[model samples]
Target chain A: MKDWEKNIRIVEPYVPGEQPNFPEMIKLNTNENPYPPSPRVQKAKEELSIDILRLYPDPTSNLLVEELANYYGRKKEQVFVGVGSDDVLSVAFLTFLNSKKPILFPDITYSFYSVWADLYRIPYERPAVDENFQINKEDYYKENGGIIFANPNAPTSISVDLEFIEDILEHNQDVIVIVDEAYIDFGGISANSLIDRYENLLVVQTFSKSRSMAGMRIGFAMGNERLIKAMNDVKYSINSYTMNQPSLYLGVEAIKDEDYFRENINKIIFTRENTKNSLEKLGFDVLDSKTNFLFISHSQYKAEDIFAELRENKIFVRHFNLPRISNYLRVTVGTDAEMECFIRSIEEFLLKRA
Target chain B: MKDWEKNIRIVEPYVPGEQPNFPEMIKLNTNENPYPPSPRVQKAKEELSIDILRLYPDPTSNLLVEELANYYGRKKEQVFVGVGSDDVLSVAFLTFLNSKKPILFPDITYSFYSVWADLYRIPYERPAVDENFQINKEDYYKENGGIIFANPNAPTSISVDLEFIEDILEHNQDVIVIVDEAYIDFGGISANSLIDRYENLLVVQTFSKSRSMAGMRIGFAMGNERLIKAMNDVKYSINSYTMNQPSLYLGVEAIKDEDYFRENINKIIFTRENTKNSLEKLGFDVLDSKTNFLFISHSQYKAEDIFAELRENKIFVRHFNLPRISNYLRVTVGTDAEMECFIRSIEEFLLKRA
Candidate 1:
C-alpha cells in the first residue's frame, strides 16, 4: 500500500440489505413499502418539464421545506432536508458530535452510527440494550458528549415510550439528542412533538419507508431553528445541491397526499400483525415489533440455515451476522400475498427437516 | 444558541449563482448548458417504471459505471460516480487529502475548495495564481499533502497545458493530485488521457456543462483501482445510494447519444468565441476563456453597478464580492439570442455612464 493511502480515514463500511433485481422473487429484505407511492407523486413526475434539466435546482429546497413545515404545524426554519436519512445522520455526526468525551448510543441500534463515529474520528460508546433489547434510559442518563439511537430500533423493532424518551432528554440538557424515527409511522409516537420543549432535540425521519419513495432518496430532520441552521452550515459547505429538481418536485407531492399516506400506513400495520401471529404459530419467538417488520427466531432451526432455505425457495429477508442478533431474521412486511408465500416456504422447509 | 451548539463546527458557505424562477429573465449566471439534454435521455427518464419506487436503487451503480467505462476505454474498476461534481470532490477531500501537511491549490480557483477544507478541517494553503490568472507549476513544487486546482480555472477561464500538469505530477510522486476538468470539454485537452501513466492522478468531470444534466446531478472520477476503492469505502459510510435510479438510467442514455453531445458542445464553443469578440469590441478586457463562460471586466464601469442595471432589465449574471476580482463578471454563454440581449443591455449601461 502507498504511504498516502495509509493516512486515509478508513472504517468497516455499512452494508445495506440486499437489493435482488430478478422478478418472481418475494423480496422483503429491506424495509421498503409494499404499496406504490401516492398518485399525486406519480402525476408530479409525469408533468415535469424535460428542458428544466439544463439548470441547477434550488439549493435551499424552499418549496419542500415549506410543505414539511406546513404538515407539522411548524415554521419553515424548524425543518431540514437531505438526500436521505443516512446523509442527514452523517452531517449531524460531523456538525454536532465533536466533543472530547465519547458520544452515547445503544449497542444494538442501527449499525451505521458506530461506523460514522469511527469514520469521522468521533469517539463513541454503545451502551448495551437490556435483556429485552430496549434502550435503557439509565444507560443514557450518564454524562456524554451527545446521545442518539433509532426509535423502533432496527433488527429488534421494539420502541420505547414517549415518557422514557423525555426522561433521557430531561437529564441530558447540556448535550444534543437525536431520535431517529425511521419507522415511527408504523406504530411508535414521534419525538417531533418534543422539539418545541427541548432545544437540543433533533428528530430525524425518512420518506423511504412510509411514503414508498426509496428510489427518490428524500429524508429530513426537525428541531430548534438554531440546530437546523448549524446543520445547514455544514450541508452548504459540502454540497449546495443535495436534492435534485424532480426529487424536490415529487417530495412536495408526496407530502401533500395525506389520505393516501394514512391508508397505506394502516395497511402495513395490519399486515405486520398478521405476520407476527403466523411466525409465532410456527414455533418462532417473535419480538413485540412496533415496526413494519418482524424480528423472529425459531426454537430449533438455525436462523442462517432458514435464511438460506428461504432464498432457495425464492424469498429474501435480512439476517445480521452480529453477536446478539445472529439467530434472528428481520423480515420486512410485504403485501399480504407476498408474505403468504414467504410463510408457506418456511413451513415447507421446517416440515421436511423434521 | 444552546450550550451544545457551541461545539458545532461552522464555516462560511459557498454561494452558487442565482436561480430566479421567472419566465422572461435571460439567465446566464450558473454556467449551465444552453441546450436541453439529449432526446434519448428524456425518453429514458420517461420510460422508467414508477413501480420501482418501492425498491432501493443499486448502491453500486453498476450500469452507469459500465457505460462510463466503455465510453472512456477503461475498466469498470477505474471509474467512480456520485450525485454531482461537488459531491464527488467532497468525497475526494474526505478520502485522499488527509495528510498532515497543508494541501496546495491556486488562491482564486473554484471557491468551494477552501470551504471544503474548512468543513473537513483539512489544513490548506492557497498560493497565488500569476498576474495573467494562470497557475504556476513551480509554485506547487514544494512539500505538500496534496494538490488540486481546476484546469481552465473558474472565474478566470484560462487553461493550463497538459505538459504543465505532467510537470507537477512528476514532482510529487507521494501525494494525490486532482485535476478538476469541469470545463475541459469546452476547449482544453483532458488530463483523463494521462491517468494510465500517473498512479496518483484523479480527473473529475461532470454532465452539468456539456451534456445538460445539471438538474439530474451526475459526475464521475476516473483514477486507479485503489483510489476508487477507497472513495467507495468513504461513500458507503456516508450514503449508499447517493445517485437515484432515474439518474443512473438516464446517465447511460446520455452517454449513448454521443452525436448529440458533440453537437451541443461545439455550439457552445462557437458562441463563446463570438461573445468574446463582441465584448472586446465594447471596451471590456475579456480573459482568454476556454470555457462555456466569459470572464470580462470593463475599464470604466463598476461591475457591481453594471450587475444591478442588468438585473433591473431582467438579465442575470454572476459578480463575486471577493477581493482582487471584484470588478469582473462571469457570464455564462447562453443562446445566441440571449447573448444578443445581454450585449444590448451592457451597451446601454456603458453609454449611459459615458
Candidate 2:
C-alpha cells in the first residue's frame, strides 16, 4: 500500500453481508424482503420519466421527511432522512461522539458501529450485552458519551423491552441515545413513540426491511427537533443532495401504502413462525425471533457444514466469519415457496450427512 | 438545550440558495440546467417498477463504477461514487485532512469547505487567492497538510492554468491534492491529465453538471486505486449503500448517451459566450468565464439594488452576501430563447436604473 494519509492508513474497513453472485442459488442471505414493494412503487417510477434527472433533488429531502413525520405522528422538524440506516447511524456517530467523551454501545450488536467510531477517531466503549444477549439498562445509566444499539439485535434476533429502553433514556439525559430499529417492523414495537418524550434520543429506522425498498436506500431518524437539527447540520455540511429522485418518490409511496405494508408484515410473520417450528422438528434450536430471519443451529449438525451443504445444493444462507455468532446461521424468511424449497433441500443435505 | 455531546453543540447549519415560492418568478437562483435531462432517464425509470424497489441496491455501486472506469480508461478500483460531489468532497475531507498538518484552501472558494472543517473539527488554513481572485500557483506550492479548490472557481468563474496546478502537485509529495471540478465539463482544462502522474491527485466531478443527472444524486472521484480505496473505506464506514438502483440506471444511460450530452453542453457553452459578450457591450465588467455561468458587475450600479430589481422583474440570479463578492452577481446560462428573454429583461432593469 502507498504511504496514504494517516487517517486512511489507520481505518479498518467494514465488510457488508454476503451478496453472493451465484445466479442459480436459492438465496436466503442479506435479510432483504422477499415480497416486492407496494405496486404503487413501480407505478411511481414508471410514471416518473428519466428527464426529471436533469434537476437536482430537493437538498433537504423535505417532502419525504414530512411524509415520514406524518407516518410517525411527529412534527416535520423531528424527522430526518438519509441514504440508509447505516448512513444515519454513521452520521449520528459523527454528530454526537468525539474527543469530549467516549461513546457506548452493546458489544454484540451491529459491527459497523465500531467501524464508524474508528474511522472518525471517536473513543467508544462496548458495554457487553448480558449472557442472553440483552443490553443492560443499568449499565447505560451512568454517563459516557453517546449510546446506540440495534433492536432485536442481529444474529440473535432478541429484542429489549421498550420500557427498559425508556428507563435508560430517562436516566441518561446528558448523552445522545440512538436506537437502531432496522428489523423492528417484522414483528417488534417501534421506539418512535418515545421520540416526543425524549429530546436527546434519536431513533433510526430503515425502509429497507419493512417497506421492501432497500434498493431505494432510504432511512430516517425521529427525535427532538434539536437533535434532528444537529443531524441536519451534519447532513447539509456533507451532502445537501443526499437521496436520489426515484428513491425520494418511492420512499414517499412506500410509506403511504399501509395496506401493502401490513400485508407483507403478516406474510413474513407467518413464514418466520412456521420456519422456526419446522427447524425445531428437525432437531435444530432456533432463537425466539421477532425479525424476518431465524438465528439457528442444529444439535447434531455443524453450522458450517449445513451452511456449506446448502450452498453445494444451490441453497444460499448467511454465515458470519466472526467469533461470537459463527455457530449460528441467519436465514432470511423468504416467500412460502422459497422457504418450502429451502426446508426440503436442508432435509436432503442433513439426511445425506447422516 | 439538553446536555448533549459537545462536538456538535456548537455546530451551525448551512443555508442553501433561496427556493422562493413565488409562482410567477423566472427562477434562476440556483445554477440548475434550464433544460430537462435526456428522455432516456425517464425511459429507464419507467422500465423498472415497484417490484425492483423491494431489493437492496448493490452496496458497491459496481455497475456505475465500472462504467465510469471504462469511460475514463481507469481501473474500476480507482473510482468512488457518492450521493453527490458535496458528499464526495466531505468524505475526502474526512479521509485526507486528518494528516499531521492542516488543510490549505482558498479563503473565498466554496463556502462549504470551512463548514465541513468546523463540523469535523479539522484544523485548516484559508490561503487567500490573488487580488484578481485567481488561485496563485506559488501560494499552493508551499507546505500543506492537503489542498483543494474548485477549478474555474465558483462565483468568480476564473479558470486556473494546468501547469501551475501541476507544479503544486509536484511539490506536495506526502499530501492529497483535490480539484473540485463542479463546473469543469463546461470548459475548464481538466486536471485529470495529471492524475496518472501523481498518486495523491484526485479530480472530483458531478453528474449534476456534465451529465445533467443532478436530480439523481451521483458524483465520483478519479484517483489511483489507493486513494479511491481510502475514500471507499470512509464511505463504507459511514454509509455502505450510497447509491440507489434507479439512479444507477440513470447514470449509466447519461454517460452512454454522449451525443445528447454533447448537444446540450455545446448549447450552454454558446449561450455562455453570447451572454458574456452582451454584458461587456452594456459596459459591465465581466469575469472571464469558462463555465455555464457569468460573473459580472458595473462600477456605477449597486449589486444589491440590481439583484432586487431583477427579482421584482422575475429574473433571479445569485448575489452573494459575502464581502468580496457582494459587488458581483453570478448568473447561470439558460437556453438560447430563455437567455434572449433574460438579457432583454436585464437591459431594461439596468437602463431604468441608469
Candidate 3:
C-alpha cells in the first residue's frame, strides 16, 4: 500500500440486498411495498414543471416537512427529512451517539446500526436478543452513550409493544433514545406519541414501506425541537440540498392520499397473514410478525438450501448468514400471487428433499 | 442544558445562498444555470414509469455512473456518483482526509470544505490567497493530510492554469489532492485528464451549473479505482441509495445531449463577457472570470449597499460578509434580458448615490 493509503478511513460497508432485475422474478428481498405509490404522486409528477430544473431545491424541505408534521400531529420544527431513513438514522447516530461510553442496541436488530457505529468510530455494544429474537428491555437499562433499535426488528419480523419501549425509555432519560419505525405502518404501534412526553425520544419512519415510494428515497424523524435542530445542523454541514425537487413535490402527494395508503397497507397485511398460515401448514415455524415480512425456519431442512432453490426458481427472499438467525429466511410479503408462488416453490423443494 | 445534550456533536453549518421565490425577481444568487435542462430530460421524465417507485433505486447508481464514465473517458471503476457534488466532497473528506496532519486549502475557497472538516473532526489549515485572489502553489508544498481548492474558485471567479495545479500535485505526492471543478464547464479546463497519472487525485464536478439541473441534485467524482472504491465504501456506510430513480434516469439524458450542453455553455459565456464589460465601464473592478458568475466591487461604493439596493428592485445577487471579500459581490450571469435589467438597476443606484 502507498503511504497515503495508511491515512484512508477503511470500513466494512453494510451490504444491501441484491437488486436483481430478471424480467419475471418476484423481488421480495428488500421489504419494498408491492403496490405503486399513490396516483396523486403521478399527478404531482405531471404537474412538476420541467423548467424549474435550473434552481436548487429548498435546503430545509419545508413543503414535505409541513405535510409530514400535519399528518403526524407534530410541529414543523419537530420534524426532519432526509434522502431516506438510512440517511436520517446515520445523521442521528453521528449527532447523538458521541460520548466516550459505548452505545447499546439489540445484537440481531437492523445490521446497519453497527455499521454506522463503526463508520463514525463511535464505541458501541450489542446486547444479545433472547432466543425468541426479542429485545430485552432490561438489557438497555444500563449506562451508555445512546440507544437505538428497530421497533419491528429486521430479519426477525418481531415487534415489541409501546409499553415495552416506554419501559426502556423511562430508564434512560439522560441519553437520546431512537426507535426506528421503518416497518411500523404495517401493524405495529409507533413511538411517535411519546416524543412530546419524552424530550429525549426520537421516532423515525420511511416512505419506502407503507407508502410505496422507495424509489424516491424519502424518510423523516419526529422529535422535540432541540433534537431535530441538532440533526439538521449536522445534515446541513454534510449536504444542504439532500431532498431533490421532484421528491419534495411528489412526497407531499404521496402523504396526501390517506385512503390509498391505508388500502395498500391492508393488502400487504392480508397477504402476510395468509402466507404465514400456509408456511405453518408446510412444517415451517413462522415468527409472529407485525411487519410486512415473515421470518420462517424449517425443522427438517437448512434455510441455505431453501434460499438457493428459491433463487434458482426466480423467487427472491432474504437469508442472513449470521449466528442464531442463519436458519431463518425473511420473506417480504409481496402481492398475493407472488406469495402464492413463493409458498408453492418452497413446498415443492421440501417434498423433493424428503 | 439537558444532560443528553452535552454529548451532542455541534457544528456551524455552511449557509447556502438564499433561494427566494418571487415571480418577478431575477434569481441570480445561487449561480444556477439560467436555462432549462436538455430537452431529452423532459422526454426521459415522460418515459419513466410510476410503478417502479415501489422499489429502491440502484444503490450503486450504476446507470448514472456508467454514463458519467463513458462521457469522461474513465473506466467504470474510476467514477462515483452522489446526490450532489457537496455529498461527493463530504464523503471524500471523511474517506481520505484522516491523517493526523492538517489538510490545506485557500482561506477563501468553498466554505463547505472547512465545515466538512469540522463535522468529521479533521484538522485543517487555510493558507490565505494572495492579493490577486490567487492560490500560491508554494504555500501548499509543505506536509498536510490533504489538499482541495476550487478551480475558477467561487466568489473570486479566478482560475489557476493546469501547470500550477500540476506543481501542487508534484509537491503533495504523499497526500490526496482534490480539484473541485463545479464551474469548469463554463470555460475552465478539468483536472480529469490527470487522474490516470496522479492516482491520489480526486476531481469533483456538478450538473447543477452548466446542465441546468440543480433541482435534480446530480454530482460525480473521477479518481483512481482504489480511491473511488474507498469513497464508495464510506458512502455505502452512510446511505446506500443516495440517488433517486428520477435523477438516475434524467441525469443520463442530461449528459447525452452534447450539442445542447455546448450551446447553453456558450450562451452563458457570451452573456458573462457582456456583463463584465458593462460592470467595468461603470467603474466597478471585475475579476477575470472563467465561470458563469462575476466577482465585482465598485471603486466608489460598498457591495453591501449595491446588494441591498438591488434587492429593493427584486434583483438578487450574493454578497458574503467574510473578511477580504466583504466589499465584493458575486453576481451570477443571468440571461441577456435579466443582465440588461441588472445593469440598468445598477446605473440608477449609482446615479442616485452620486
Predicted structure with the largest lDDT when compared to the true one: 3
Which should have the higher DockQ, number 1 or number 3? 3
lDDT by residue (tens digit), candidate 2, A104-158:
8888878888898888778888888776677787888776888887887886888
* Number of colliding residue pairs in each model: 0, 6, 0
Per-residue accuracy of model 3 over A1-354 as CA lDDT, tens digit each: 997688999999677779999999999899999989999999988888878888999999999999999999999999999999999999999999999999999899898999999999999999999988888888898999999989888878889898998999899999999999999998899999999899999999999999999999999999999999999999999999999999999999999999999999999999999999999999999999999899999999999999999999999999999999999999999999999899999989988988
TM-score of chain B of 2: 0.96
Per-residue lDDT tens digits of candidate 3, residues B1-354? 999898999898667678888889998899999999999999998888989888999998989999999999999999999989999999999999999899999999888999999999999999999998988899999989999999989978999889998999999888999999999998898899999899999999999999999999999999999999999999999999989999999999999999999999999999999999999999999999999999999988999999999999999999999999999999999999999999999999999999
- State residue B339's C-alpha deviation in candidate 3, in Å: 0.4
Clashing pairs for predicted structure model 2, backbone only: A42-B49, A42-B50, A49-B42, A50-B41, A50-B42, A215-B55
lDDT per residue (tens digit) for residues B1-354 in model 1: 667776687777666667887779999999999899999988987888778876788999999999999999888999999989999999999998888899999989999999999888899999998887878789899999999999889989999999999999999888999999999989998898889998889999998998898998899999989888889989999999888877888889999999999999899989889989999999999999889999999888889999999999999999999888899999999999999999999999988988
Q: What is the TM-score of each candidate against the true structure?
A: 0.99, 0.97, 0.99
Q: Which ten residues in a row have the lowest lDDT in candidate 2 chain B?
A: B1-10
Per-residue lDDT for A20-70 in model 1, tens only? 866798888988999989999889888888798888988889999999999
The whole-model lDDT of each prediction reads: 0.90, 0.82, 0.94
Distance from true position, residue B250, model 2, in Å? 1.1
The TM-score leader among the candidates is 3
**Candidate 2 segments exceeding 4 Å error:** A1-9, B5-9, B21-24
